[model samples]
Target: MKQLAIAASILGLLACSPQGEAKLSAAPEGFDDSYLQKMGFTVETVEASAIEGVYQVITDQGLIYVADGGKMLIGGRIYDITGAQPVNLSENAIRQMRQKDVAAIDGEAIVYQAEDEKYVVTVFTDPTCGYCRQLHNDLQSYLDKGISIHYLAWPRTGLQGSSYEQLKTVWCSDDPKAALTAAKSDKRLPAARCDDPVDAHFALGNKFGVRGTPAMVLPSGELIPGLVPADRLLNTIKQSQ
Candidate 1:
């Protein structure tokens, strides 16, 4: 089913409930979550907003707003301009969620440890993505800079067909790292399959709003949505620290 887009009309900071009462412990009693689920949204969280009656909804795709007890829905990011510096409240919440969700899959990732590692990054990648290949070609550059990279598969095409099957082979191989390099280099692999985390990794990538390959997740849970050079990435990490 085609997913519904966030309703444009409700995209701003609407009036929220009073302070203290503004925090939603859970989806409001009057809210009908089924309505959203039916619209092809995998809603992950619902929280009360600073705006009266408005609620912040986090979904696998991104942020949206709901109001009037679920009668209205708006899709977009919201910011608090009243703060000393503008705060993207929606992104902040999503970042926290992203951090938690990415961490949960650590055991399942294809990890390349950097010697004397100073930072770790999780990356959503597709074998067919040119930029992903570019990053892979310079994989050691990141390691040289003391950045460990944990890779998660994210086929642009849905979990079916050649790409998915190829990634599955990489995950199932006796030497997954070698298999991955071979696949990314456009080499065919010996067919293989087993219980693997490719599906879970793909799902997690979607939940974190990964629209394309080479999406990098920093230790701080901030997402950088492209192939960043090792030196540039190292600088970014240092600046964040």
Candidate 2:
């Protein structure tokens, strides 16, 4: 369903609730999220928000907020405007989520290290993406600038189909780095199988808010979507830090 329509449905429910209905405990230790499930959203975590009576929820669709005992949903970022520049509380939450998830990949991702690494960036890539290949082909530019790149699989076509299968073949190969290089070059890779992390990588990409290939997550947990040049990436990281 469209997000706006879903929101309207939830709001309609909120309007129909009996007056003086007891609210869900601020501490929802045993919270029920069946309403969200009915709405087709898989709930991951539910925690009290910084605001009273509002709760923060982590779901497959990213972070969301709810109230009125989880029946009413509110969307959009929460900003703290007390500072000279407005601080995006939601971005902070998402960034921390990205950091933990990106780090969890460990050595699973195909890594290109620099001799004198100053920054490490994780990139969600799809072999079929021309820009993804361009980024891979120009790795030396990033490496030469003391930036190591870690590549995690993200099939733009999703978790099924040829793109997904091809990435799995690359991850399953005895030499993943070589296979990845070959895949980007449009060369046929020998069919292989293993306990691949491609699906896990794909899930992580979704949680990391990647809508396309060549999504880069810097060490500072900032997400830059799309193809970024080596020098520009370095400058971006420098500025963020």
Candidate 3:
């Protein structure tokens, strides 16, 4: 995993007013604004943490925390230990982020709509992944349960070689749905090209921390990292609702 360095510049964030008490209206009082740039993130939002003096920093890549007047930088999930049971606040925030990202899609996916759709989920998949192939094979099971799937290509090898070309062909074919199914079954698609959204889809998957294919983003914005059985997935979606 690529770890982001959140050292010196985070102190400036910590020194600012508490997350809820004040919004981060400006950059830290004395820290170089370039720290965020160096870290390859732009400030998506800055809010207060459950812990005093710590600020929750929501970035494009994910969430992080800063505390002790920039002396401490914490990455990964944060739990609210105040209640009877610990609450994963960081995961909650990430879910909201994922929901927003998925909702922002503007018809860039190859959709397998359920005739009597009761639920919908966004999927990031690669034709070459075994689990992705399995999911493709079982797509109808989901549809049978009124679960619509929106498929977005995230070719793991990126836009450089065979995998990329295969996925692009799938996207560019006259019948994208059939092409996807064939490709996942290891059938060769005729060479095709167009202004496909494959790259954009991959970029979004990367931003969402997708390390593997067949990543499903539920209606609630929670991500399931691998293949989930159709019935179980339906139950999971219902439980979420």
Candidate 4:
């Protein structure tokens, strides 16, 4: 099966909910793991949000918006009704969660730090991706502009076959940056073995709703997917600041 289909299959299992009037909680009772399972949520953590009558729930599938009592689940995006501009509540929630989760991954990431390190961004990369190769080539340009790049693996082919092995080889290299450059330049690494964090990174990328390589996560939790030029990226960082 394809990577997208495999991801969707995992989500399908968590979509099965009991057929009945779903109850809502009056107060935040926190996330009840068993209750969430019964209601078809592969529960991970539930967090209180600024919005009343709503809770941000993190499940194995991804982030979801649910009512206080865990009724009326919204799998997609949510918007704030009372606003001059339409505020994407779901996007904001996901951004917050992304920042928190990505922060925890700082130490684990293969980092390409800038000398000054004015801005920090996390990239979900796949070795086999063409755009990812382009991005890797311009890594120095970003560094020159004081942008620190952190890499997290997101194999386009998921945890299987040559794609997985290639990523493992890169991660296992004594100098990962050199390994990545060689791989991107069509010089394949020799067959090697090691216990790699490729699976963990792939899982995290999925949780962050990363459907493709070269997806970037800014410090403010906004997602920018695809190959963004160095100048444009600098402008974005400035705007966010």
Q: Report, for all candidates in order, the number of backbone clashes.
A: 7, 0, 2, 2
Q: Which ten residues in a row have the lowest lDDT in candidate 3?
A: 14-23
Candidate whose TM-score is highest: 2
Per-residue lDDT of model 1, residues 104-191, tens digit only? 8788789999998999999988888899999999999999999999999888886887778888999999989999999999998988
Question: Model 3 lDDT vs. the true structure?
Answer: 0.73
* TM-score computed on alpha carbons, candidate 3: 0.79
Residue 114 shift from truth in candidate 2, angstroms = 1.3
TM-score of each candidate? 0.84, 0.86, 0.79, 0.80
Per-model lDDT = 0.78, 0.80, 0.73, 0.75
Clashing pairs in 1: 15-51, 15-52, 16-50, 16-51, 16-52, 17-51, 17-52
**110-220: candidate 3 lDDT, tens digit per residue:** 999999999998999888899898888888999999999999888877667777888889889999989988888888788888998787677677666676788998998
Clashing pairs in 3: 11-70, 19-48
State in Å the error of residue 125, model 3.
0.8
The C-alpha stretches of model 2 lying farther than 4 A from their native spots are 1-27
**lDDT value, residue 221 of candidate 4:** 88
Question: lDDT score of model 4?
Answer: 0.75
RMSD of each: 6.5, 6.9, 6.8, 6.1
